[model samples]
Target: MERLINLNSKKSLTNEQRQAIYQRLLQESSNGKLRKGSISDIANSYAVCTKTISRIWGRGKLHVNEESMVDVSLKKSKSVGRKKKQINLGEVKGLPFHRRSNICSIANSIGVSKSTLHRRVQEGALRTHTNAVKPDLTEANKMARLEFCFSKINRSLSNNDSTFDDMFNVVHIDEKWFYLTKSSRRYYLVPGEDEPLRTCKSKKFITKFMFLAAVARPRFDASGNEIFSGKIGIFPFTTLEPAKRSSKNRVAGTLETKPILSVTKEVTRTWLIEKVLPAIRAKWPQGHTGPIFIQQDNAKPHININDSRFLEEASRDGFDIRLCFQPPNSPDLNVLDLGFFRAIQSLQEQESLGTIDELISAVQVSFERMGSRELNNVFLTLQMCMKEILKVRGGNNYQTPHIGKGKLERQGNLPLQIDIDENLINEVGSYLGL
Candidate 1:
């Protein structure tokens, strides 16, 4: 017989306790006796706090019966048929602009139609164009960029006898979104998966905040211990403006709710004057000032790029920080942007946050919960990207060598090297290397 404990809250059970209950259930079944207590009774007794035991007990074996197995097979067949219909609908609509593949192509791939694909895209699905054309890179500009790249590489080699790491001291900086919902609610486990599993809704649209952060290679102290020190800058997605425009014509008219615009350059100017400058002075009272290198992307009129408030403050304080923009349209280079956004989406969905204040709090909590290990993963991704660039820009060893140096180097060599890495290469490989 087992005794139940009163739960202070609706907190879920830990894995160990659940496992214990499973052991106890097995013992009861093997004995062929009426269990002293019900599954929930045993769960509460062992402090598992889950109704899963009761569910498993009532459901008996999970193995499907013959009739039910056939039913499920038929259901899947019907689902496939419905999917075909949906794909036909998409082919009709997409006929005007896009050249969609046949229904067989769609079904065999994911059993999804063009309409479903479009809806998923509209819903912010991470879909990619399989046959998208490469962006045009003129020969001249390509040559220049190649020369610059080689110059940088040579300068790196000349500066020190450092390995590949020396050539790429890239610090990727970007913002990410995080929601306030509990992580459990945000992510779902398909069951029987590996540890450290991720939740799905982490990529979904949720009310989340942006975090500006910079991830550098993990450093080590003089004692040979690794120090995972990275910079974290907070940018809460809360509104300052209370009044929001309801309609196009009502920009200056009646408002629905006061809207707090994002912390753009304008907001940073005000924030620095009021809160940031004083905080900086108070934190570094020794008056430390020097040139700081910051890597960031081009956000909507970034303060570091357009506004002089931060620069002026840094200058006044004797700290000259240069904010270098990452390559255009390259979010993969910005680790924090990816991490922060995932965090934002996860927390917001988990907490099911309603109000703006609640959302901000959730984002703050999510960032705090995120540790340096996760940050290191982001940095590693950036390193891999640099390695890939070096590989493609290499001489003859690369798979699809991007001939010439940079944009400028391409001027004299193009038309010849223009379609060097064209889509037709795999389709028609002339130089069949073993």
Candidate 2:
């Protein structure tokens, strides 16, 4: 019968085929006599290519027994495949910055394949970063940030043992807008399941409500049991208005709640007096009686410290709540803006809401549902960022600090405060001509 030939010329021979060819060649050599076309005969019989048989026959000539033939018939060595191509990262780095913006462009400029560059990236030879635009910092802004970090240090400690205060007396307050629905969402579905259908009037015109959130560092008793959670309250800026005409969803003259689209000084003052101050009074721990500072950003619409309405309610119930502004254009100084708002926003986005009221309720729920431990960690992160600001001499060019907060918490060794470098502080002081 005619034997079938391997269609792929580059296919390597298996161990069994290699051994069979070796045995046949050994038999032909042992008799000290051979047919006129023995090598080609064996190649046609085994359906292997002639080139592979010639190479195996050469190796079989070195073996004298079946054991030697078996050893010689093993698979190819590790280095048998194609050689790996190397890209000179140093050469790539010499290119203009704009030319190295993407993998395809960089690969072309550096004379390397994009797939090889991608593999190098997966192997961590190259790194990818997302750049964000930071607010410009004036000289005055830098000085203010420096002073703020200095103020948090416990100067009462000996010059050698200075550390940051626990920040228990400071309450961070900020305003954020919560939308009723996101333009797009991702959901996991079973095979053959229908995709979720969502419709909206316009992506940009989705209904959103503004909220004022207040939080403080949580307090714990001697046993580490939480006595007072940091969450003071979250109040929405909204109002109820009567519908003028009958609609498909509601009858005429029905009171419909709507978000206050434009939050002005008057609205902010009202919420502080009516909602914020009351919540703080009711939730403030009884044992601690020191004055509390409500820290906010310097926005034009925010109420000033001397606002008549806020001053009246702030001093009542034996509580001294004072309003203080963080450094101008410095959102990083506020704990809420630094990370808390983003965390709660992620949680809020998980829920589905239809009306302005439902959106408000969802945000409030997310705020309350956040754990005290997370709030405390964010406060710690804020303090760490302040240290970074000081290190950079007030410039916002430092990397975010990450000291394994989760691992620390698991080991029950999470610190309530971070220590500031005394030498760094003195250097900053001299830099500012203090």
Q: TM-scores across all candidates?
A: 0.44, 0.80
lDDT of 1 by residue, 149-268 (tens): 232222222433322232124444555544434444334567896555444455554444554444444443455354544433355534444345465545644433222336666764
Error of 1 at 88 (Å): 25
Q: After superposing candidate 2 on the true structure, give the runs of residues whose Cα lies further than 4 Å from its correct spot.
A: 1-80, 94-102, 108-111, 187-193
Query: How far is 233's C-alpha from truth in model 1 (Å)?
Result: 2.6
Model 2's TM-score against the true structure: 0.80
Q: In candidate 1, which residue ranges exceed 4 Å CA deviation? A: 1-218, 222-228, 237-259, 262-264, 271-290, 304-308, 338-340, 343-349, 394-434
Taken over the whole model, the C-alpha lDDT of each candidate is: 0.45, 0.83
Candidate 1 worst ten-residue window by lDDT: 413-422
Candidate 2 on 365-385: residue-level lDDT in tens? 899999998998998998899
